[model samples]
Target: MGPGAGEVSWRHWICDARDGRLICPIDIPSFSWDMGIGDFGFSTTDKGAGKIDESGLTLPWAAIPASTPDERSAMLDSQRRAIVTTWAASDDPEDKGTPLFWGKITGRDDTWLDTSFGLESPMAILSSRYAVRDGAFKDGHSSDSIAFTGMSYRGICSELGRIATDGKQGGELPFDWTYTGERGSHDRTDYQAWNVQNLAVDQLLTNIANCQGGPDIAFRPYWADEQHIRVRFLAGSDADVYLDMDHSPVCLSSFPDGGSLEDIHVSYQDGYHRWYATGAGTDQGTLTCYVESMAPITQSMDPPVLREAVYGDTDTDNLDLLRRHVGGVAQNNSGKLMQITGSIDFGDTDQFGVPLHPLGSMWPGESVTLSIAGFPTLPDGDYGLRLMEMSGDQGSKADLKFDVLEAPFQ
Candidate 1:
């Protein structure tokens, strides 16, 4: 008999990096994995050092009762020096398993006989590989120097793709990349000129992400199969696949009546109105630009606020680009944003006696609608939420968390 609905099946194996062999784990007990693709911003005393930090997926697993003591020892040895791969699939036969996560074993915690493994995606490898030397730009350049001026988003990503496939950096590694078209108006043209002298691949990517007026591009690298890797760039304004809450076969269950919202804050300040772009050339000078949002300033909120952000090492003096950047930052930081946390009912039946939405079909970055009662502050209509984090295990329901951004034009 085939596996029933809501039942999950998983495969855990230790992969040999040298010869590409797979060894299955023994007596796996429980597993939980978290995967996210987003931007993390950090600031310090240096105003120009702000960056858009990107992260890959992280999967940690636990095992119980090894087949033998020696078997456990071998697993530990492999965890120290071997690649690990995990595959997951629902009981539905039609569901031909998906390669959930794969990477080198970064860490492990072990008792006398039991063990757990910590894993990160291949992006970790790319982020760690830095330039050992530098060279001038030549025809078919093989060195690590930022060799482009006024490069478009596609151009920079294309160069990174070349480096990844050059057999020296990570080309020989098992990953494929797909660079989407420019999603933002500013990204269509050269937003800024890059002159990075010596930097790691991850650092260059971060610089590109921090480009003034650049779209929020996500570098998501995940397993395409047991061997192939798929790198995707999810950008702002790009049309995403929408998951309908009212019609989805997978039903979402809520707590405290349904869902709850908190952390609502709004602010306005002069710093958000002004943008300073510092150029990087001998003759290039600092450019100051200002923009104003038509939205009325809310004065009733307690604790008036002011937000100021600075972008350094930028080569663009375009007023339009600066205006776009300042406007987006102002709108995002000056409005009310909330967080909605809930769970999806994959194992239980709904009130109408129908199976809930299948948790197995969800992925990060997908849009979801929430329509529930019990929140007097929240409006009655459906609220759109973006899926940012998810956690689940076999034989139980999974949790879904979302970020609610203030709607523009409202």
Candidate 2:
């Protein structure tokens, strides 16, 4: 049973062995009050001696000696610190894999677990020490690649070249999960179609123009014709490809000309409804898919568009861009972007109100300038501005403005 019955939770503790000996070089750090699978918060409620041996932990207040209560409490506290550090380090570095010890891991994410694939993961020593493949520590030297739970990685990166790889990152590998664990829209469909056009993996393509497999399958992308999949081609050697077998059948269609629906039709192969493609790509080429529920090139939500720009030597161009943000931007996770699709130009008399394009689509990490033309050239002044969400989901306007300067682009 997981926690209660049959479900495995992300919160867990793992005992570890190194060279066949019990060591304090690994640990599981936990912080939960409801489910006590592993709850160690150095509580004033009960701080004392606890035995952590070959079997597992059995820490309780009565176990410590009265004469050394402070010392025992201090040791466990340090161990707790080490464990927290290890937990943070083991929690998915760049969402990739690494080889480092996370001695103790006790938490509640469902997909986290042990490894059978040779690929390494962060390890925890039940509640003692933690490890990550991150190399180097400041001052230029290798800190212990394996550290007791409560220590520090203050200077550990540069010193160790990242526990196993060139410390390009830190932490544990992401779970190789496909199921989103959530259902779709009002539609009862539990699955979604994914498309990676002209998908290239490791270093090989999965398509061959007008050709099927033969004795010498020159640059051929193989489809089972029965299974309807262009599986990873394993020739004289296991060719590298990233399309995992975990993929399931999902509808796929093509739009050769990005045309309307009536122009497209279903394709059949070997007399089975199981096969089809839109011939959406290059004529000789084919798209291999069992089903396709959505299109490959989806129209992104409209970003804020700049209507018109009037450039000049100074602030004399226009003073209206700041009058009122007629149409703002759309947003997902990485913050808002400007989109002025329905914006209106109030005419040259108030020409400044026209939304002129800034640096186009403002991506997550890019910055650009937005200017207005035809305003009284002045040293500095405050202008009125407003920001809004497209749907007005929040039902409130962000009443804000910024200071503008008359300084020309120098």
RMSD of each: 9.1, 27.4
Candidate 1 local Cα displacement, residue 183, angstroms: 11
Q: Which lDDT tens digits does candidate 1 get at residues 1-410? A: 11234355554455543333455443333344455443221111111442211222222224432466676566556333334323333555444354444555544556554344544455455565443322333456444333444445544554564454443533444444344233322242332112333345555555555444443444443555554444444444323223223344322323344432222222222324333444333454556565443343444444335444564444444566555555555555454455666655444445764435543455555666666444445554566666766655433455666655664322
lDDT of candidate 2? 0.20
lDDT of 2 by residue, 53-149 (tens): 2222333334322236464433334223122111111123321111111223222121122201110112122112122332333344433323222
Clashing pairs in 1: 164-171, 249-357, 250-356, 250-357, 250-358, 251-356, 251-357
TM-score of 1: 0.60
Most TM-score-accurate candidate: 1
